[model samples]
Target: MLSDFLALFFPRFCAACEGALAKGEKVICLQCDYKMAKAGGLTDNNNFVAKKFFGRVHLQYAWAYYLFNKRGRIQRLVHRMKYDQMPEIGEFVGHKLGAALLRQGLQHEFDVVIPIPLHKSKLKKRGYNQSEYFGSGISKALEVPLDAGAVVRTVNTASQTKKSRLARWKNVDSIFDVKDMAHVRDKHILLVDDVITTGSTIEACALSLQHAGAASVSVAAMAAAK
Candidate 1:
C-alpha cells in the first residue's frame, strides 16, 4: 500500500511511449507493446538480417524481434535501455524474443546465448550491459545458459549512429575478441545485441566466434533497422 501511495504522486511512465503507465504495466504500455510486437521480424531462417551477412560472415540464423525506426517505440525503448537508466527494458525485450522463437519452435536451436560485450570503461559508466539483460531473459526463458564472457569488447569504439555504413563497419570490425574458446567451440552460439543497424558489430562478433571454431553462430537482437 505504501508503494501504491507513493506511486500516486510519482507516477510511472512507459519506457517506449512516455505515457503514464497504468497499474500492472511494467516497462511499456499495452498499446505500444502490441504495435512493436506485430512486426514480421526475422522469423524465417533466411531474413533481412541473415542477408546482411551473406558475404561478410557465415550465420546459421539471424533474426530480430522488431524493426528500429527513428523516434518509434523501438527507438524509444532502446534509448531508455541504453541511456535513461532503464535496463529492464532489455529483459522485457528478451522475454518477447524468446517467446517468439518458442512459438516458431526455434528456441532450442542454440546451445548458448551471449550478449555483445561492452568495454570496461563504458560498462563502468553505464553500470550494466544492456545486451546482457536481454541475454539473461532469453537464457531464463529458453533454458539456455548466458555466457557473459564468451566474447569481450577489447576496443572501445565510438558511436556508429552517425557513421556511414562503411564507416560503421570500420569502427567495429576488430572490436570484439573471443575470451573463452572452450565455451564457444563446437557450440551453436546465439550472439545478441540491443539493436541491429548496419550489421557491422554483429558481423564482427559472428566472424570472431566462427574463427574460434564455434560450430555455428546465430544472431539475435531486440530491433533490426531496415
Candidate 2:
C-alpha cells in the first residue's frame, strides 16, 4: 500500500525512545508506554501529588500520570514537547490519562479544566501553551469545558529548576490573577499543568482560583519529579 511504502522510506519514531513506531502506535510506542513509571492510586486522597500540597493548598484531588526521573524517557518526551515543537505529545499523554480517569468514574468530579497559563511574552514565543493542549485533551475526554482564559500569569518568574522549595514558592507567589471570576466561581476546577516540580506553581494557581471563589480545585499533571 502507498501508506506502507511511505512508512518504509520515512519511518516515524517514538517520541520517548526514538525507536521506529510500529503500526497502530502513535506518539509513543507500546513498549515505551508500558515501561513508563505510572503514578498509580490516583483515586486515593492521600496520593503523592496530594501530599505535596498537604499544608499549602487545599485540593479536592491531585493526580499525575507519570513519575518523572532525570534523563529518563519521560524527560526526553517532555523536552521534545516543550522545546522541540511537539505539542501533540502533551495531548496524547493527556488523552490517555483522561481515558483512564474516565474508566475510574471520575468524569463528574470536575466542572471545568483550566490549564496554568503562560505569561503573554512566553506564549508569544512558544506559539502555543503545552498545558493548554493537555487540558484540551482532558476536557474532550471528560466532556467538560476547557477554560484557558479564566486565569492569567501576571509575572514571568525565573525558572524554578534550580530554586529551593521556599524560593520556588516566593517566585510564583501571588503571580496568578483570575481574569473573569464568574467562569470559575462555584465550579470544581481541574487545574492542568505539564509537570509538578516543587508544587509551587500549582499551589499559586490553586490559591488564585480559591481566592476567586472557585468551589473546589483539583490538580492534574503529565508528570511529577521523583
Candidate 3:
C-alpha cells in the first residue's frame, strides 16, 4: 500500500523521547505509556489540585493526569505538545485521563465538556488550542460532545510564570466570557486544560461558566504542578 511504502521511507519517532517508535506508535512509545503516571485523585474532593484552588474557586472535583516536575518526561511531553504543534500528544494524554476517569464513573457526573479557550491572537498563531484538542479526546472517550467555543478569552495576558499568586489572579480575572449560555445553563461543566500551574486560567474560566448559570464546575487537565 502507499501508506506502507511511506512508512518504510519515513518511520515515526516518539515525540517525548525522540526515539524510534513502532508502526502504530504515536507521540509516546509503548514503554513510556506504561511508565507515565495516571490521574488517581480525579474523583477525590481533597486532592492537591482541588486544594490549590481552595478559597479561590469552588470546584466539585479537580485533578490532572500526571505530576509535573521540571525536566521530567511529563514536562517534556507537555513542552513538545504545546510548542511543537504536536496536537496528537495532547489528545493522547486526554484519552488516557478520560479513560481512567470513565473507569471510576466520573464521566457520568458531568453533562458537558469545555476547553479553556486561548486568545484569538495566540490561537491564530498556534493554529490550534491545545486544551481543545485535549478536550476533544476526552469527549471522544467519554462519548460526549465538546463545546469548543463555549468560552472565549477576551484579553491577552502576559505569562504568569514569575508572577505572584495574587498577581496571577489579577491577571486572569475578567479575561474570559461565556458564549451561548442556553446550551450550558443548569448543566455540569467539565473544564479542560492542558496543565494547571497557578490555577488562575481555570478559575477565570470557571467563573465565567458559573456566571452563565452552569449548575456546577469540575476541572481536568493533562498534568499538574508537583
lDDT of each model, Cα atoms only? 0.83, 0.89, 0.83
On TM-score, who's better, 1 or 3? Answer: 3
Q: Which ranges in model 3 have alpha carbons more than 4 Å from their true place? A: 1-11
lDDT of 3 at 192: 97
Best candidate (score: lDDT): 2
Q: Which stretches of candidate 1 lie over 4 Å from their true place?
A: 1-11, 37-39, 159-171
lDDT by residue (48-90, candidate 1, tens digit) is 7787788898888888888788877788788888997777778
lDDT of 2 by residue, 1-226 (tens): 3224434554489989999988799778999999999987677999888999999999999999989877889999899889887787888888888998999999998999999999999999998899998898888888888999999999988466787778778878879999999999999999999998778899999999999999999999999985
Pairwise lDDT winner, candidates 2 and 3: 2
User: On a 0 to 1 TM-score scale, where does candidate 3 land against the true structure?
Assistant: 0.90
Ranking by lDDT: 2, 3, 1
Q: Give the per-residue Cα lDDT of candidate 3 at 60.
A: 89
TM-score, every prediction: 0.89, 0.92, 0.90
Q: Quick one: RMSD of model 3?
A: 3.2
RMSD of 2: 3.7
